[model samples]
Target: MRRFKGFVRGVDGLTRDRGGNFAVLFGAVASVLALGVGFAVNISQLYNARSSLQSVVDAAVTSTARDLTLGVIKEADAKASVQAFLDANSAAGILQANQIVLDKLTINRTAKTVQADVHADIGLYFPLFSVGDMQRVTTSTTALYSDKKIEVAMMLDITGSMAPNWRSKTDKIGDLKAAASQTVEDLLKQNRDPGDPRIRVAIVPYAEAVNTGGLADTVFVEAEGGPKVPPPIDTPLSVSVTTATDKCATERKDKDGYADYSSDGPYTLRQDNKGKTYQAKVNRDYRMKVCPTAALVPLTADMSRLLTAIDHFQAAGVTAGGIAVQWGYYMLSPSWRSAIADACLGAGPTNFDQKKVAKIAILMTDGQFNTAFARSRGASRSQDQGQVSRSNAEAICENMKRDGIEVFTIGFDLNDPSMTTTERDQAKSVLKDCSTDDSSSLKHYYEAANGAELSDAFGAITRNIENLTINR
Candidate 1:
């Protein structure tokens, strides 16, 4: 009986012993903690991989959509384009190019969208405890694109400085023609139907004044009477209204004032009490110092006529940028549609519709605006013409932009060593303010140092216009 009791006590002692129990519990807990840490690390890695994949996919889809919209690639080539983009940049963060794959690509022609799905197999850091060896991160992106009908009015500066002179050996006019022609061709040749072009362009070559061609009678109020006018009587019963013999037109002095931005008008005619019955504002007999003969061409898709007009461009007169900008706005303004129709220039600009149509104005200049007329012959006061031109251009641009017109301005060689500090800043300021404020703030304004840069700027503008947008 004593032996049995001793054995029972020994068993109870063994059961109550705390030795090694702590070590076993700690081992279990350590294993679980290690697993938790590994899982957290892998999750972070997977998140980074997903973000990179999403970025690449978005870029790929946007690029492909732009190509598709530009007709540079077809739907069948879309997958390849997306694949190429992925291959180039798939190994962005915590992922390798070999681990990434383009799973699917969809081109919705009817909806004008391109969508892409991409996936990456991220290696797992925590593969124990029945967890998989890899985790999948997937992302999809969609881009919307279109080639809406576009109307572009180009205000080209053909000032005397543009010609080959002792000051400049380079032919700036030649460069301008090439760059401008390429823009027209690129924008117009995209039309699948020539009979109904999606693009129409107008050329406003301004020197001292805008040559209105046959549009003078329709747009400007001509002053009556000249050296051959009859004496002024009480009624002036037998007065002769001198017809406009010169096609050159300058700023209006109508009831709307000098800086009026509207194109709709039966402008008030100028009057004179003397036997010289006609006032000087619209007097055809008065000639400008340097008038451009390359008359303003209204919006048209006729490449031949446009090219011919560009070919005949002559560098003469001082820069009349404000008047040129006014004419540019008029070409695109709907109020002047009837006048254009009356002149038999094809159906004028379409009404402003942000989605279905786009209106653009590209103004180019090589020097500061130095000329403006306050009366029939010249300025009434001695004022800085550059400031006047800049202010007027800004006002006109403000009105044009309010109407949804996108303005782009180019200052070619404005930074040349020849220009004074004040002159350069003033010239650049006008161009910059006149341009549309883009998201990047650089796309709509260009400062070209040379002809090559000019061409590149134009190309960039064209691409920006055709660029696709990613859906939110």
Candidate 2:
């Protein structure tokens, strides 16, 4: 009885001791805190996994939809494709989506819609609060199926500055050819069918004037007389009356006419917008010095000929990049299909609108636009040919953008060997203004200091264009 009472007294003393109370409280709080920290870590892991799964799901569904649009995969096979994609790309265990279910795969031909609903069982790292081992993730993707085609026109500047500069020892034109050829290859690879690709490309090499080649006889209206009197819209005589042999073609200008000479219809190449009766005439000397040797190649999928055209690129003459930009716009315009003949796929889908077809222009130049056949702002600083050419380029870019054609511009070696900060800034500014103002979202303006950067610029443009056409 005495021993039992002693034990009881000891227990009572221990229980009443306040010195050990904090230890018990700390033990309880530490356990709860540990559990909370572990839960947070597990939750964060699940969130990261969910995000990765969303990306994979999006890509898989989009690819499947594209295949469906191309008739490469049927609805029955789409599930297999999606599953294979998921198995292959579970973001390296970030998304352990073990179970996949296709809730819906709707392809409405009449509506031209492709919709997909997919769900996956993503394994959980930690099952919190009696949660299951897996968490369900659902995602959907939709694409508008259309028989949209792609038309691209490369407006290359083969100016004197692009030639092999002995001082810099850089062949700018050679770099351009390589870059352009790669662009062609990339674009052609995007086509589901190579034999009859839905994509077409046109090359317009410009300097002082655009060389229409065979189209010259058919496209141009003759000079009315000598240097004194220009030709009117009527009494055409381009093929019959030219004493000069150079095929350099000039632009049409009328104060009462539109902003730029569109390649759609028969346009009269007048003298200038200075007055109504101005005579439009170019002598032989001007053509020989400024005319580019590279012949124009219209929309052709013939890869061999396309490469050959790039080979034909020879650097000569001054920069009249505006003319090239205008031609690039015209080449894609359906309104000019009558002149294009077999150049563009049937002028179907009607009008020169960019609804069904993606029209792109890649305009690259190495120097300032110092040469202009017209736009001479008489006696004022506006008469600065470089400024005039820059304005014209911006104007053409504006018009093309209005017509839904995306324009990308590049200034290559704009400031050779480094110049004053002000000069460099001006050069960059001009290129910026000429490019599509997608500065923040997608930079349409690029500047290259050397050949490698120029090639990189083309590659960047190619990727963006691919995204715009295929992934959009």
Candidate 3:
């Protein structure tokens, strides 16, 4: 009985010990605090993995969609393409190279979409109640690609400067040919049907003038005498009069106060007060200047023909860049469709349809525009040939933009040490004003210094032209 009472008293003493009770409480609290901190760390790890996986998937799907749009890869290869891209960039943020897996990929040709589902296995630092030791983070992405028909008119410069410099080994013309040809291949599919094509490109190589080739007689009036007026509006030209003798066409004569830059034409003989017949005359002095050896090719999907024209490009003549821009505008203008059709260009420019068709012009030049025959319609700095040409080009570019044609301009080697400050600024200004001012995804102006940069610029422009849109 005395021993039992002693044991009971010891238990009571232990329960009343404040120091030991406090120690027990601290141990319990420490265990819970450690678990909470570990849980938070696991959550943060999962979030990082999830974000990394999502970004990789988004990029993969977008790249796949672009390839599909560009015909770089077939739809059947899309799964492999996405997986490859994901694998290439798996270590984006706290992600192991092989941790992420491509679970599913869908290429819906009818919907023009590329969809991808990807997941990454993240090892947790601490596993808590109801939470597993490993967390699986899944992400999906979709990209919508446009299959809109594209009409591109490239105005290439073949001025004297583009020729190989005797002092240096720079070959601007050669670089241009290579880059431009590659751009055509990237933008268009091979072996397209002649009758029905989704894309067509026109090459306009200009120097002193745009060599209209077969389009000369159709668009330009014969320079038999001076501008004479008319035999009624619909009267045909007298067969006795010779057809346009020169293939190189200059700016249209500003006769009867007509808009010189306007492509809308009944390019036939016009009527004066009396019913006599005469057509607008081509500028004699301008046409007599050294014309480029390469001619303007109307829009066509014939890859062979397009590439062949690019190959035969020869640099010569003064820089008549404004005239080139004018012709570039005409190539994409539906108003000039009949003439282009007469020249056997495939299904000429389609009517302006914002949703279905993309009309584009890429104007490139290496030097200042120093040739103009038409009087300036805008405010010209000095009414000299350079200022007049700049004004004319700007006016035409504004008209093109107003008509829904997207303009992209490249000033190739404009900053060369040989060019004067005024010349460089003028060249850049013309191109800047001509290009579409987009504050969105891609810029419309590209200043390429060399061959590789030119190729890169063209590649970027083609991607933007494909118009890929992404959704997550």
RMSD of each: 8.0, 5.8, 6.3
**Worst 10 contiguous positions by lDDT, candidate 2:** 279-288
Which scores better on lDDT, 2 or 3?
3
Worst ten in a row by lDDT for model 1: 224-233
Compose the digit string of candidate 2's lDDT tens values, residues 1-472: 9999999999988877866887989999998998798788777876776677677777777777667645467667876877787667764446544554667777766665566677767666666677767677777776654455778889888877678877868888888888888888877665667665667788888988777654554333334432323444443666335444667755544343222444444332444444444333222223335677787777777777778888898888877766777677767766556555633433422255444677888888877776554453342554666666666677777778888888888888877755566656766777787677784557798888888898899889977775565444
Pick by TM-score: 2 or 3, better one: 3
The predicted structure with the larger TM-score, 1 or 3, is 3
Q: For model 3, state the Cα shift of residue 143 in Å.
A: 2.1
Q: What lDDT would each prediction earn against the true structure?
A: 0.76, 0.67, 0.78
Clashing residue pairs in candidate 2 (N, C-alpha, C atoms within 3 angstroms): 222-238
Best by lDDT: 3
| Model 3's TM-score against the true structure | 0.79
Q: Each model's TM-score, in the order given?
A: 0.72, 0.77, 0.79
lDDT of 3 at 305: 91
Model 2 misplaced regions, further than 4 Å: 1-49, 65-78, 94-98, 107-116, 121-147, 194-196, 218-243, 255-260, 267-288, 342-350, 376-382, 418-426, 470-472
Give the clash total for candidate 1.
Answer: 1
Rank the models by TM-score, top first.
3, 2, 1
